[model samples]
Structure formats: C-alpha cells, structure tokens
Target: MKPGALALVTGANRGIGLETARQLAQRGAVVLLGSRDAVRGEAAARSLDPDGARILPVALDVTDTRSVAALAKRLERDHGRLDVLVNNAGVFVGATAADTTAEVTRDILAVNVVGAVAVMHAMLPLLRRSSAPRVVNVSSTTASFGLTSSGADLAGDASVRLAYTASKAALNMLTVQYDRAFRQDPDLAHIKINSASPGWTATGMNGFRAPRTVREGARAVVTLATLPDEGPSGGFFDEHGQLVW
Candidate 1:
C-alpha cells in the first residue's frame, strides 16, 4: 500500500489546479491530474512531478459524462477508491463577457456547474469506500454573499463578473446541501465536504495579471484536501481562515 492517501484534481493542466496537484503530490498523495487535453495533461503531470511519485495523467473532460464514468472505473480498478476530489474547473465570463447570450451562459454553467456535479456523482461511490473521504471545491470570494451585499465590503467592485459569480454562488449552495446530506447519513457523514476560495491569483482564467502566485493561491485548496478526519465540513475558507458566507 502507498504511504499516503490518493487524490484527483480537475483542470490541473495549469495554474492553481496544477500547483495544487504538485503540492498534494509533495505531501505524499497519489495525485491524478484530470485534464481535457491528454497531451497537456501528461505534460503538466510530468512538469510538476518529473520523478513521478504516484502521479498519473487521466484524460478527463469534466463536461463529458462518458469520460467521467470511465475515469471513475479506472480509479476503482487501479486505486480501489478515491480519497480526495478537487472540483477546480471553472469558467470566468469576464467583464466584456457580460454581454454573453443565454446560450453562452448555459455553456458556462454546463462545464462549471453541471459538469462538476456529474463528476461528484460519479466519484461518490469510490469515495464512500474510503475511511476519510473529502471533496474540496475550488470556489471564489465573489461567491460570498457577504462580499456582494450592497453595504458590505467589496461591493460595487467592477471585477465581479455576473455570470461567473452566479454560477459559483450556486456551487456554494451545492456544497452546503451535500454537506447536510452527508451529515444526515451515518455511513457518509464521515466525508468532509467544503468550498474554498483560492483568492486572486495570476492564472489564465484571469490572464495571469493577479498578484498572488499560484503557490500562494493553491494553499487553501491543499489544506482542505488534506484535512484531518475531524476537520470542519460545509464551510467556506480562504488562505487566512474561514470566510463569512
């Protein structure tokens, strides 16, 4: 058996997701890089972990059901179960993207919201078999009600992209609902599920203009992914600590 747990991270070909995968692998987990492009996935996996500590490249397009199911089956056969799942894939309909048509909105939601749910559904059984199962959602601070409220801090910030924010807000609720469901069931309550904000980082999503390095932004995700069995669930946190929902 491996000395540490096993983990899978979606959208790990670059940016925060790749950095998080790297950090998790460094911590001893057998990390799988889930990417849409097989070549990019394998390349990223190698770049982050040249010596290969248990890291593998799994060709995964979260929006594709068959691919998701196939990855689940492969993991079941290879690892028996998955210990961690990081829902890090997201789409940011930027400032100019506000003019996006309903079709565009649906497309974004398909990958960011529906696709994530599908992956979660597919991975649940494998996770159930693990003693310490964890689902860490890579969310954004813009999803915070506290931040978006009119009188609260960061209100009126033009950086808030409507379509993207709404998608993530819905995702946060999804996290809460899943946590409640897990808690209600004795067999699954042991699973820790939480949403985390990676903060503003220089990634392709933001055009790599943000100040924080990918390493700095990936910390909260790595922390939540490797949480102790007793760690909090259904909470939202940033790098410093928990955030006000």
Candidate 2:
C-alpha cells in the first residue's frame, strides 16, 4: 500500500472488517473505521491504534443514504481523496432456505447488496481524485454456484444460508458491473473493483462457529484493497488466488 493512503472499511467495529483496518494501518495508510454506531466505532479504532496514529472512527450506516452521503462529505472535507474502500458490512439472518422468508431476504439484500452499492456510489467522487483507487467487496464462497453444485463440503453446509448466499451472489455481480463500467471509461480505468471471499471466519455473523481467524479472513480483503495498478479487476478471489465466479 502507498504511504499516507486514505482508506475506509465499513462495519469495522469487529471481526474481519476490524482486522482489515488494522492491517491497512500497519501498512502506513490512514484508515477510516466505519461503523453504524459511533461509540463502538470509536472504541474499535482506539483498540487498533490507541495513540490515534493511523485510525479514525466514523459513523457510517451504509443502508442509510443520508449517512453514506455524510461520510462522503466528511471524507472530501478532511481528505482530498480516498485510495481504498472495503465494503465489508454484511448480515446473515436466516438459518436455512426452508425457514427463510421474503422479508428476511429483503433485509439481507438491503445491507449486503443495496447498502454496498450506496456506499460505492457516494465514494466514487472521492475515489476519482486518487491516482489509483481500489474497492473490495467482502463476498463469500457460499455465493459460488460452481462450488455449491459441485457437492463441496463448505458449499453443502452453506446451502442452508439461502438469504446470505443469494445476497452475496448479487454483490459479486455488482462488483463485476462496477469493474466493467470503470474499465470502459477512460477517466475511471485506474479504479479497480473486485470481490473477495474470507473463507468462513469465526465472526459474529456466523455465531463464531467458523474456524478461521479474523486475520486469516482479512488477508484477501487487504490484498485486493492494496492492489497495484495492473492487478486483476472484476474477479472473485480468496487468499490463495482467483476463485471460480
């Protein structure tokens, strides 16, 4: 990552988001830890960097357009441009497809799909100011149809999370669309957009049942967020390499 780069990670109060922010800070980027709750966000930021050296807590509720706009405005005022954005804020509500309802699906989409798009739209102007900007959408392997249908162990178990899986699949498409649109535009070609799967981390979203640690889950996100100008875009990747989209 570039020194003094300005980065933002949403839902950074805990779990993979928090770890991503920490890693970015360690790489010399001034990271904005975004959370829906101001207090928790501040606390999380302090925990990562007690001296307030690299982390700044910001109240950002991606689902709310007003909140998203407010954060954009603040970023423009405080920092001329944003170099990286990690759309890590997501929710997994329903346990199984059999028990999932329309409302639950809507709620999941609102945060995982719609909310992520909102944040990206609002942050585009700021990102445009940077020489090289990157966006990493925290996706999941559960979104992969190839794996799900291949009778893989993880996919077989994730099949029960209908709402989460569908939402992430939508997010993956959103990443592709954004990358395509940016690449087609001469002025925006430098912007890289990609989706990442953290490989079933033990986060609150999963009741802490997942075996992977937060650091392990955050590696892929940080890698995409800090990609070079020539890095691949419109791709779904994990820590190892590109994943089957």
Candidate 3:
C-alpha cells in the first residue's frame, strides 16, 4: 500500500494492533482503527492521530457477522475501496492439552480463524476495487508446526495452550488459502495475502510477560501491509524475514 492508502485493522484498541495502526497512519494511510468497544476504539484512534485525519475509530467485532457486514457496507458507501486489511483480532486462552475443552477450542477458533475470514469475505468487494490490495493475518510462532512439533521451546511456556496454538495454526492455513484464491482469480490477482508473526510481545494477551515491545512486534505487520507490487504473498514472515509455517 502506498501513502494515502485506505487501511483497516481489527483489534486495534491495544497491543500489536494499536501499534500497527499508528505505524500505518504515520506512513500516511487512512486507517480504520477497529475495536470491539467503540469508546476504546475512539480513544485509540485519537491517540494515533490527534487531528482525526489519518486514524478513524470503528466498532468491529469480527465474531459478529452483522458488525462485520455493517462496517463493510459503511466503508463501501464512504471510501468505495480498501487498500489494506490487517486481521489482528485474536484471543489467548492459556490451557494445556489436558485442560482444553471443546467449548474453549471452539471459542478460540471462532475469533482467530472464522472471524478473520468473515471480515475478509465482507470486504472482498471493496478490496477488488483497489488496484493493489494487501491483507495481513497476524499469526504467531506457536502456530508453526515445524517449531512446535519439533519440541522447540520457542515463543514461551504460555504457548502450550492448545486452544490458542490451534487457532493460530488454522489462521495461518486460511491466509495461505486466501492467497491462493487471489492468485487463481484473474480479477483478484493483484491482491496479496500473507501471515505475519509479531513474535512474543509484552501485552495484555500474555500478561505483559513477553520481552518485545509493541513497536518491535508491529514491524512485521507494517512491512507486509505496505509491501510493493513485487512483494511475496502466501508466506509466513516476521520482522526478521520469512518464517517457518
């Protein structure tokens, strides 16, 4: 996405999402700062852009189909096109495999996987209208089957949560699928979709125990979100470069 591009970031009220929105705004993209709570969203938007020119608050609950549709309709009516979409809304439910329940797993998938796809489906039309569109799915190192299955003690001990890891793994798959769809569709070939890992960041999602700062974590998102026309898609990456999926 270029300067002045239109962008929307879900779960932008805080953490990596908030930092990503701020960075996008600094690059001159008009960003819709999405949060489940409208008040908190507005507060976040203000913090990103005090003049209310670059960052705008939006009430978006990815798990709510109606809310997702409503926002898409509003964006279509106002902007008519979306240049960037950052699916950053996710939940962390730390429970070991033995402690994980069906309900908990289902709930995690609903938001982390289904919700991101829902938003993408709703915004496809608007995205198609743009000459160049980018979609970034926020993922995690815990989602990497290579790392986890290999007994790599990466990310952290909190990553043992089956529900959270599984959700992100599914999300990474969805990102690849979406990228494939765009490549196969002639009219949508310009659209790029990639999964980005923020690494372990110190945020509420992890009790702020992680070592990375929000800015450090958001680099991957911003990089892929603003990729040039030649940038790669359907790959998992972080600030460092390509990552194991």
Per-prediction TM-score to the true structure, in the order listed: 0.94, 0.97, 0.98
All models, RMSD in angstroms: 2.1, 1.1, 1.0
- The C-alpha lDDT values of all candidates are 0.87, 0.92, 0.92
Clashes of 3: 0
Local accuracy of candidate 3 as per-residue lDDT tens digits, 138-207 = 9998889998878887867853577898889999999889888888999899999999999999999889
Error of 1 at 53 (Å): 2.8
Task: Report the C-alpha lDDT of model 1 over 117-185, residue by residue, as the tens digit.
Answer: 999999999999988898998888888888678445542244547778778888899999999999999
Q: Which stretches of model 3 miss by more than 4 angstroms?
A: none
Better of 2 and 3 by lDDT: 3
The TM-score of candidate 2 is 0.97
lDDT tens digits, residue span 79-171, model 2: 879999999999888567678888889898999999999999999999999998999999999888888788767722564688888999999
lDDT of 1 at 201: 88
Residue 221, candidate 2: alpha-carbon lDDT: 96
